[model samples]
Target: MSPMTRRTYSFLRTSRFLRPHIIALNKPPFAIPAYQIRAMSSGNPTSKMLTANPLKQIFSQESRPAMGVWQMLPGANISRILARSGADWVMVDCEHGNINDAAMHEAVPAIAALGVSPIVRIPDLQPWMVKRALDSGAHGILAPLIRTVEDVKNLVTAAKFPPEGKRGFGSPIAMQNFNPMPTFTEYLQQANGSLLTMVQIETQEALNSVEEIALLVDVIFIGPFDLGNNIGHPIIEGKMDPELDEAIERILRAAVTAGKKCGIFCTDGEQAKQYADKGFHMISVATDYTLLGAAMADSLTIARGQGKQDKPVSY
Candidate 1:
């Protein structure tokens, strides 16, 4: 076997239970039945381009080039705002921020209308939660704190359907964008095909097992802040320590070896650039709350600079 390429699951290092599931793609009752269907975009009159689905289209090319912003506002509006801002994608921050399933119920659809993919960062690997987000019409899924091959396996099962994984089957509901009245099979092929899945490898354990984990995922969106915090450098935003830097390098290299795209979430332009140069193609530059806070701070500074403010500069 080659050094970097280990025939991809060549050795039976995984447990028997997992080995069965690992081969889910090739196994019975786990394969997604492929069907040739006419491609359909969301029925937005303004969107004339041909897209199978908004979310799946992002991964059409191997690069999956995108720049997203997380958490733009307090309510569901952030998704739409980020879309309007021309972001290719945006992740509703349920893992760290206060985005519950109910919140996603309201936010995801709104974001979709704005012509950008809305990915959800779920709190855990609960299949129901992942299924809930997908059922609720999520364009993509961003699972946080992925640490092992087991984690990847669970996510795969949760996110995909049979012959691939064990995602439940339901074609029409308020969840699948309520295609008014569509058959179950019709919804399955369209929605599942358009689904995009991504995972974060931020924790020390995840960083260590990232090579194997990367093999199980399509994209690697590194969480810099939480990763640094996990490594004892909390709140040292935009600062790079050698150990952390090396860890980040290892992650990127692993993604390359695993044939996956690498992405980083940072709240600064400089740090974004640093990771970009390090081979991160898809990245999120800031959060919803952070953008507002920074703009507020800028306003305050400018106001304070005005020596004699007769009244607040309101325009």
Candidate 2:
């Protein structure tokens, strides 16, 4: 017998699981194996799986801040276009945006399919809202108006599965957005650990318990406009009050001390860069509505052949 035939016979003898199948076919010992032929027939027989969350991957890079955009308009195409803009994450703003539950459902998969994390900013800290957001395959839930440590705890409970929190599972479509599409079992295994839980510290009550709340959530996001208003230091004449600035710094400090990520809202890239340099882990660079309005206004000014008009101030 040839050496190659002898080796094939040896391999078949050793592979007890394949021996019966191979023998039943009554094929030549040197003939190509069934497994090899199957693998060859299947184009790119390699499987792809998610190793980590996209936002988590950004956060893991030391000194690199995650730049995000807020989606106030509700459309899957709009969400996909924004995701293609190279933002690390996109906030589907249900809290203040025109997005309803149906729109959110459409936007989440669209955003996620582009490898950008879709973080849903729910209208409130209600558990049902949290459940709905998570069930839609959101990578995270940003609960607005968190007022206490208990609120943070409850938010976490609603976002996680059992043994960590009380969230229930059974979404057949949740895993569809993931690249190469993980099985339901794989999705369940990674969901709790991969999903981020964020609470917005925009109220005076939440500010007072910032430190305690920071310890419970993965991120402490500050809504500067609402925070200033809630704390009786609303931004006046387009200028931030020193008191509001101090409160913002305090929240940043609390988040840092607790070893949690800190995020804030900014109107432009310059403002986002400033916060990023100030040790904020996540920063929202702009909202969809504002960007569209600003771009159109600038375009119209240029078309009129007028001296560049001063940009309007926005929060």
Candidate 3:
């Protein structure tokens, strides 16, 4: 028998004692009233979020941590390497390292094409730089110099879209597949979740407020050199200084307490492992330029050792 039969309709039409949902199959599930409907008709909200975020499941499931690399390789091929490496994420350093939009245009899409998350570390927490990186197809932004919770709030405002942020919408941009017909309402809804905002907590002032900063930031990356400097211990000391180490520990503790992902750069694999063990999920291993310089110096040293005295190179 047809479920929506004339008799059923007549009964519903004439009766007021019914559940008001006699034709329950016609109702939408997960609605305002929360009525039960066909299982296939509605999608799970948590599952949808998980499907959208690769790291969502990682953070939810057992302790599978993510390691990041600060790949500043030129010509934009950096993205492909990160995508194929099965890395949890990567950062395109446009900060103290050498990078420009000319390079970012190629790198951002290349990274996106490879399906690895590309985080752009802008030179500063400038709004234009933030917008430019996003418009170029970056999935997240790793901004630096977050001294307090107020700084985090400001950065968050810049990273978000209308009512939450001030990012200028560009539907014609390549990020939307260059779709010229994106509805503003639909685009705004997607932008909030699709975009990830991160801020750095590397200074003494920042460390003092690390707990508050962590609570406000989505992801946090540490500037090791700057951190050491801010803590009055230069990296030239050649080892993790006592105060700097303690400060890092403090930040990690606060981050854990706030349930936010903490990140920092390691001088090498061993250092990275140390930080990871200390409860850092998002870790930046090395920079492409630094790796190349170190490799070349090591190769030259090896060649010289075969013929003459060895002398290590320095920047």
Candidate 4:
């Protein structure tokens, strides 16, 4: 027999327990029967199966900052690849990506399976959008283009279920995405506090209402490009525009004063590090499209006899 065939046989023999749960494509990955899962896990009802929100723990404690990448693609395969690559979280960009509700349902579980938080950036602050994303087991929601305290307040309400807010829940696959899956009752109880509600501080109105907005949401996420554009500076490559710098610092201060976490969009690891140094709790280091494009461009340059490649700037 071939050596590779022998190795495959050995692995299969050793992995007998996984055989029953293994599923084919064109079906939900967690389609393992409930009885089988119960048999595999302990029979104790008090013993929960998953934690449901790992990012909640990370954010609650003020230890090391969280790092994440933005995913603008639609497939579960792309999300799975990035999740396994060691990012603390993955922001699935439904706002700008061609992703729809169906695609998000596929991607969330794939990212969560790798123990990484899957935060969906909803296109807008619509209640239905928040409900769909949350029902799909998103650890959090990132709302873009937030301009007023009312916007953040409305988003928080849409994200939480009463008596805190008014979000209706009805997803069968919800708790499965968490690590130590909770009971149905526990999910309703813990979800409101655990799930993050982040709103963008980009436009002038948002910056002006920064203090009030900070107090209303779990996180104040800065959209640097929009903020720069609103301020009429428009962020430039490697150039430190004083006006833009002041605006960022103002938002950061507002969040800190309100005792809320802060997040920002960063283009690369180096920029992410700088933001972290400024005490931002979460930083998006890169995006899948940006990384892919840069790699493809580099390869093409080398093929054309170019010695080195220049860094990419996303504006």
On lDDT, the candidate that comes out on top is 2
- Give the clashing residue pairs of candidate 4, or none: 49-180, 49-181, 50-179, 50-180, 50-181, 51-180
lDDT of 3: 0.65
Q: What is the lDDT of residue 309 in candidate 2?
A: 65
Q: Give the candidates in order of lDDT, highest first.
A: 2, 4, 1, 3
Q: For residues 1-315, could you state the per-residue lDDT of candidate 2 as single tens digits?
A: 789887877787668765543443344433535553333212121222233358866765556899999999999999999999999999999999999999999999999989999999999888899999988888788999888888888888888765577877656566666665655444554666666889899999999999888888889999998999999999876689899999999999999999999999999998888888899999999989998988888888889997566866755
True-structure lDDT of candidate 1: 0.66
lDDT of 3 by residue, 1-315 (tens): 356565665675456664332323232211212221122122243433224444433555658567767777766666676667677667888887668888877776676565566678988878888888887767678888768777788887777765566766543343432122122233344555545678887788888888788887667777777888888986774566788778878877887888877788765666778777777878766667766777787777678785433333221
- Per-candidate clashes come to 7, 0, 0, 6
* Index of the highest-TM-score prediction: 2
* lDDT of the structure predicted as candidate 4: 0.80
Pairs that collide in candidate 3 are none
Q: Is candidate 3 or candidate 4 better by TM-score?
A: 4
Give TM per candidate.
0.74, 0.82, 0.74, 0.82
TM-score order, best first, reads 2, 4, 3, 1
lDDT of 1 at 207: 89
lDDT of 1 by residue, 248-302 (tens): 8898999889887788887755656666676777888777887776677777877
Q: Any runs in candidate 1 off by more than 4 Å, and if so which? A: 1-58, 62-64, 171-184, 190-193, 232-237, 306-315
**Stronger candidate by lDDT (2 vs 4):** 2
Error of 3 at 50 (Å): 5.9
| Candidates' RMSD to native | 13.5, 12.2, 11.7, 11.1
Decide which is better by TM-score, 2 or 4.
2
